[model samples]
Target: MPGSVIGINMNYGYPGQASRHGDEVSRTRPVATTSEKIMFGAPVVQNTDGSVKAWEAASTAANFAGVAMRKVKAAKIYPYQNFGYYGAGEPCDVLLRGGISVVCAWGTPTIGGTVYVRTNVAEEGSPEEAKIGDFGAEDESGNCIALTNAKWSSSKDERNVAELTILTRQGV
Candidate 1:
């Protein structure tokens, strides 16, 4: 019999289940109006109407909400939560500070190094060109994606796994 790997998990833990590291509480938010598609691991913010949208460089720190725990389409239901397998794509259950994510490399990512949210994050590419600290902090000091492990890379074709512990001044 040939050996086979079941699934690809750079890290461990379900969306709501407790992991060895610890259990992180997830909160639900409403989806905001946006043309951009929502994906897992991407940072997000709160709109004036209390809806959640993707977090970008222009997004201010005070408005910093959390990372999208699932894929949210435009014009969906309110109060989203991760209810799928590992919570890949569900809705609003955004993971704010203290949540860990196994993010795909959109740039050359390194362990313990910081990564930023990109609207155009490539499937696999060198993040060297990616801007650092684009999270729109009060000082414009960008929110940082702190890596829990070192999976550094410089190739754009290679898929790099980055474990991120989102670190920002603002919290949910």
Candidate 2:
């Protein structure tokens, strides 16, 4: 999540696929709206020696949100809204994921709240694609939270443990 992905999105920015409020075309931008949401920008490419080097997006996509475009950020979010989907549903809970540090309070997560976590995300879109967005409300109170406090276990201790684990539906 520290780095950025730049590429042409197949879901959006096309002729035949151009339709307002349509999922047929996805948008391409710095994907940050959805937690754990991963999107690969165009492959990084190398120009020297005809090698493909990594390249980030040279431009930004515009959201058609009725709200003042001023509020629309140069970010990866819904096409027509100020706040992008919290992605606080189903598998996208950032706190309960395995790598999240146990310090986070996972019980009773509100609609759009962030719980302190220490989980390592996948290379780019691996975990995001696997993380099915959710749209339910939970109360993060005195409950048995599923904080998989597993320290970084990658060969480089990269904290990729959560990548291999599929989070349960929901828990505190």
C-alpha lDDT values of all predictions? 0.43, 0.20
Regions more than 4 Å wrong, model 1: 4-23, 60-63, 71-91, 119-159, 168-171
Q: State the TM-score for model 2.
A: 0.15
Estimate the overall C-alpha local distance difference test score of candidate 1.
0.43
- Predicted candidate 1 versus true structure: per-residue lDDT over 67-133, tens digit per residue: 5564334433344433232221334666655544444434454444444443333334424555432
In model 2, state the lDDT of residue 121. 25
Query: What TM-score would every model get versus the actual structure?
Result: 0.51, 0.15
Which residue pairs show backbone clashes in model 1? 71-89, 80-92, 80-93, 107-126, 107-127, 108-126, 108-127, 133-142
Per-model C-alpha RMSD? 8.6, 20.4
lDDT of 2 at 10: 28
Score candidate 1 by TM-score against the native: 0.51
